[model samples]
Target: MSINSVKGAAIVTGAAQGIGKAIAIRLAKDGYDMALNDVPGKEDLLHTLADEIISQGRKSTIIIADVTNEKSVVEMIKRTVSELGILRVMVANAGIALTIGTEFLDTRLEDFEKVLKVNLMGVFLCYREAARQMVQQGTWGRASSVNGKRESHRDEHLIFFKEKKNNHYRAAAEMKKYGITVNAYAPGYIDTPMARQALSVNENLSNEEIRQQIIQRGSSSSGLAVNLGTPEDIANFVSYLASEESKFMTGQAVSVNGGVFFG
Candidate 1:
C-alpha cells in the first residue's frame, strides 16, 4: 500500500541504519518527502536509502550531519526546507547507547557526557529547529516524533535516558499553540542493527542465542506471545501521529512494544 497524497517533508535523524533507516523508508512510503540525516561518515548508507526512497517515487535528500552539534542540526533543518519546501514532521531518532550491563557506575564522565550530548541534546537541537520552521509555515499536521526504546536491565544510564524522554511532554505543551503535536514512540525488544551490535559484544552467546533471549524477554512482558517487534512497527505508529487522525493526541508517549510497556 502507498499513501497517494504528499504529507509534506519529514526530517529523520540517524536515518542511515537501524530503526532510523526503517522510519525514513516507512515515512517515504507514507507519502512524505524525506530529508534523511546521519553523521558525515555514513553518507554511503544514507545515499543508498535515499535511492530506495526515490525508487518508491518519493523525493529524498541525504543530509550528512552531526546531531550532537547545534550548528549542524540547525543547518540540516534549514537545508530540508530549502530543498523540500516545508517541514511538517521531525523524527529525532539519532541516539547512542553507551552503557551496557551495570557499567554505569564505572562509566567515565566523558562517556556519560557523550551519551547525553548525542541522545538528549541532539533531540533538543532537532526539536527546536524543526519547531521554529513548522511554526513559521503555520500549517496543520505539524508533528514532532521521538523514539524511546527498551533499556537494558541494571543500567543506571537508562534512568538519565528515560528522563530525557520527558522532553516530549514539555515540547508538546509548548508547541501545541503552533499546531505542532509532540509525541514519542516507546519501543521494546525490536530487532534492529543496534540490538545486533550490542549483542555482538557479548562473546559468551551466539547471535541466535542472543536473539532468542530478546524474544523471550519480550514475550514475558508482552501480551502478545513469543514475538519480537520490528522497526516498521514503531514507524507505523509514527505515521499515525504525523497524520490528521491523531491531531487530538499530544503530550503522550505511545507504547509500540506489543503490550510490554504502558505509558
Candidate 2:
C-alpha cells in the first residue's frame, strides 16, 4: 500500500496516561497516527484523546488487550494494519510496578508471577506480533538484513552494549525481515503520578529527607546530580527514535536518565 499515512501509525501500549500518554501525544504532533492501548478498564479517555488527534487531521485507534496474551497481541497488530493500513512503529511501553510492600517472605507467588507476566511477557508478545506484521509489508531494509548476510570476525563486538535496554533488538531483528525498524526507550525515574504514589509510601521520612535520599541515590547511579526527569524528557527521546533521523541507530537503549545510565 506504500504506507499512506503522512508520518506513520504507531502502536503504543499503556498510552492511557503518564509517560505512555506523553509519547503518544508527541508522536501525533509529529504527524503519526496513533493506536493507543491499555488493559481493559484501566483507561476511559480514548474518546477524548482521539478527539485531539482528529482535530489535527490525524486518525486514532483504540485497542484494549492484555498484551501478555499471544492471541490478543497478534490480533492487535493485524487490526492496526487492517484499520490504519500500516503499523510503522510499535512502542512496548505497557508495564506495571511490582507491589511496593510485598517482601519476598511475605509476597505471594501469584503476585510475582503477575508482575513478570504483565511486564516481560507483555513486551515479548507485542514485539513478536509487530515484527510479524512488518515482515508481511515487504519494505526495504539495511545491510544487516539482506539475503545471506554475515558479519566478519573483524567486526567490533563492543560487549558493553549488550546490557542496555532501550534498543528493541528482538523487535528490530524481526522488523529487518519486513524492512521495518524497531527501537525502544528505557526511561529512568520519570515524574509520573504512579511514581509519586510510590514515593509517598515512605511516610516516616519528611519530604526534604526523602528528596535528599533520592538525589543521593540518583547521583550515585547517574554521572550527574540532575533532578528526577519529567515525562516530556522521555517523550522527546521517543520522538527521535521513531523518526528517520535515527535510521542508523538500531539495537540501542539510549538512556535518558540524566546521565544515570550512559551509552
Candidate 3:
C-alpha cells in the first residue's frame, strides 16, 4: 500500500536504532501510531524517538524486550496491545549475530546454537505471538474476513539451507490464517552499526582499505549510486512490505544486497 494508505499503530522491534528506528519514525510520519522495542539500555534512544513521534502528534509506547525469550516476547506483545490498543504490523526485526573468527571445526558448538537461537528461532516465536494478536485485529479491521484455517492447511513448503528452514516457515504458516503477512528481508551491505564494527576490525586490511572493498562491491552491482546503502534505504523497502499494500505477498526472504546471492 502507499504510505498514505498505512494507518494505525505498528510495533517495530530493535527500533532504538538502525533500520528498526527508521521504520518506526517513517511510519510515525505517515500518521501510524507506534509501539517501539529495544534492549534495556537503549531506553534513552527510544525516548528521543518517542518525542519525535509525539512531535508528529502520533501515539507511542516504548517496550524493552529480547525477541529470543519467549516469555519476554509474549509479555512485550501483551503490554504493547493493552497500552497502544492494536498491533497492525509486527516487524520481527530483532536479531543477534557475529562474524566470529572460529573455523567450522574449531568453532564452539555454542556459537552455532546461539546464532540459530536468536536469529532464526527468535523470529519464529515473535511471528507466532504477533500473528495471533494481529490476525484478531485484522478481522476487526476489514470486511469479508475468513475464519482461521484448519490444522492441516498450516503446512508451508520452504527451502532448507542448513536444517533451519522448515522451523521458521512452520511459524509463518500459522501467521497466514490471521491475514497478517510474515516475511524476512535478508540485508546485504547496508551500513548499520554491526557491519561497521566487523569491517573496522579486519586485521588483514586498514579501515580505509576495508571500506574500499565494501564500496567497490556495492557500486559495481545493480546501479548502486553511492557504493554503500544506509539503513534507511533498507527501511524504505521494508516499510512498503509491512503495509497493507503487500497483502498478496508473504513468507518471502527478499535480499536487498545490490547483486549478492542471486539465483
Best by TM-score: 1
lDDT of each: 0.76, 0.63, 0.63
Backbone clashes for every candidate come to 0, 4, 1
Per-candidate TM-scores read 0.86, 0.76, 0.77
Encode model 2's per-residue lDDT on 1-263: one tens digit a residue: 12344666788888887888888888888878888888877556766777777776778889998988999998898878877776677888877654333344665667656755766677777767776666666543221110001111111112212322222466565555455665556666566655555545454655455546556543233345545677789888888777767776765545566654455
Using TM-score as the yardstick, the better of models 1 and 2 is 1
lDDT of 3 by residue, 1-263 (tens): 44444376678788887777887888787667788998899999999999998777788899898878999999988988898777777776775544523334554667657766666666667767777777766642211100111111111112213334454455556566666566666565555665555444455554455557655544233344333456777777777776667777765666665554353
Evaluate model 1: give its lDDT: 0.76
What TM-score would you give candidate 3 relative to the actual structure?
0.77
Better of 1 and 3 by lDDT: 1
